[model samples]
Target: MASLQNAKNESHIPAELLIARVMQIHACICKLESLKPSKQVNSLFTHLVKLCTPPSSIDIKTLPQEVQEMRESLIVLCGRAEGLLELEFATFFAKTPQPLNNLNLFPYYGNYVKLANLEYRILDENGVVQPKKVAFVGSGPMPLTSIVMAKNHLKSTHFDNFDIDEAANDVARQIVSSDIEFEKRMKFVTCDIMQVKEKLGEYDCIFLAALVGMSKEDKVKIIKHIRKYMKDGGVLLVRSAKGARAFLYPVVEKHDLLDFELLSVFHPTNEVINSVVLVRKPLF
Candidate 1:
């Protein structure tokens, strides 16, 4: 995968071939009413992931107008596929007696485990070793990152999870309800991130989920809003993407985080799909 900061020179892959592959994957994804565990569905997703793992020769910005439109449409479709997958498993786990134990049932649960560990390491390196209170914006129906962090890493940290969908929040609450410790530590708020201005300052660290803002403009708006209300010196971790992964998630540029002091950005070369951008609110 290409790191946004240090992308390699363009590869020799033909743009037409790439577009064809993208279209094939797009068609398969579109046919799905909901994501489930099937050999065919698994194979399709595997191919999709492999297709996106390589650095593209064609710069997304320099793509032909029609190709760019296709790219945008594909990205939106992929995001919806991901959401449906999460909701499918979240609804399933919500009815189970022990949701945490059944997390493995979700095909991508291990990915979230890796992501949580990665983010935790970034926080530790940036002096946020033990954030007392953390806020996760756009925490979807699964809320796997918070659940993983609370269970494995930040045992004592209190998490305030915000989601625009009340149904998602309800499913998230039920998913964690059986765990006594999680029940005490995790609180889900059903509202958009933009509406939680006054309470933002209370968190030691804030996480912006990858799908929080599908467009660059909307992402910048949310980031700026967080910068305005976040406490001085607070840590902000925004999930971004690079290289071919940018086709699946929005890429956050350094300039998008205008007011915050840019700390570090890590783009994983492995199966970890989202890039992590860590920044801090300037004390001054």
Candidate 2:
């Protein structure tokens, strides 16, 4: 009900909780209902960009119905909060409205595909009905997409999408054979993520994907936690091979711990570094 936490089983954002947050934000913005639609929408997006930029999870691409209701509520609440919200809109979009395009995926977001391949390869090496051993972080459409692709590509690696977004899970369930197939592959849970770093330890391999946008300090904290979970001789299939300049790279080097190697970097469409680094925790 309050920032739910579960790193395994399933990760999800309840509709009820989402509605509550919207209500609260709207109450604060109820004085500017008289503003122009353009100004009002702009104001709302701005506030969203600031207050909810890195959504609790990055798995959700489209806002859900309840969330849409909340957005409407904020527009109706239009006043001082709306004014400030519009300012936020001006700052973020500056001019563009929300795009009508599909999959606002950023360029160079290739790690998901590689991670899927790693999962598939592991399944090929193992068996189906794995006993809740593997854990994936940040499962959104991309990760699930990877799983579907892997399954079709080789009938391997049955993994469930572990994300905190219900809407995302809904999307994953849409593919024809995806329900049963995804059910076998995915075990959804509402995880705190930090908790995952604690409870799950020493996997055969930890497939990870780090991003450039994360703050250095937060990134370090996450890596330190991940280091604790890996089993000795365990491998880390990481996205972003050039991350030696990134925080985790430095931390791994500083501690003189992982045996890191770059597997390959492929371009889906001329994007940079489909960089995939396979890292193994040292035996010592």
Write down the lDDT of every candidate, Cα atoms only. Answer: 0.84, 0.40
Cα-based TM-score, every candidate: 0.90, 0.43
Please write out the lDDT profile of model 2 over residues 122-192, one tens digit for every residue.
Answer: 44443322333455554543343345443454344444334555544444344323345445655555554
Model 2 TM-score, 2 decimals:
0.43
lDDT of 1 by residue, 1-284 (tens): 22222222223446676566667677777787666645666666666676676665445777678767776777776677677679888999999999989998888888899999999999998899879999999999999999999999998999999999999899999999989988999999999888888899999999999988887778899999999999999999999888777767888988888788999999887779899999999999
- Displacement of residue 280 (Cα, Å) in model 1 is 0.4
TM-score, predicted candidate 1 vs. hidden true structure: 0.90
For model 1, where is the 10-residue window of minimal lDDT? 1-10
Residue clash pairs of candidate 1:
none
**Total clashing residue pairs per candidate?**
0, 25
Worst 10 residues of 2 by lDDT: 243-252
The reply for model 1, stretches above 4 Å from the true place, is 1-16, 27-43, 55-58
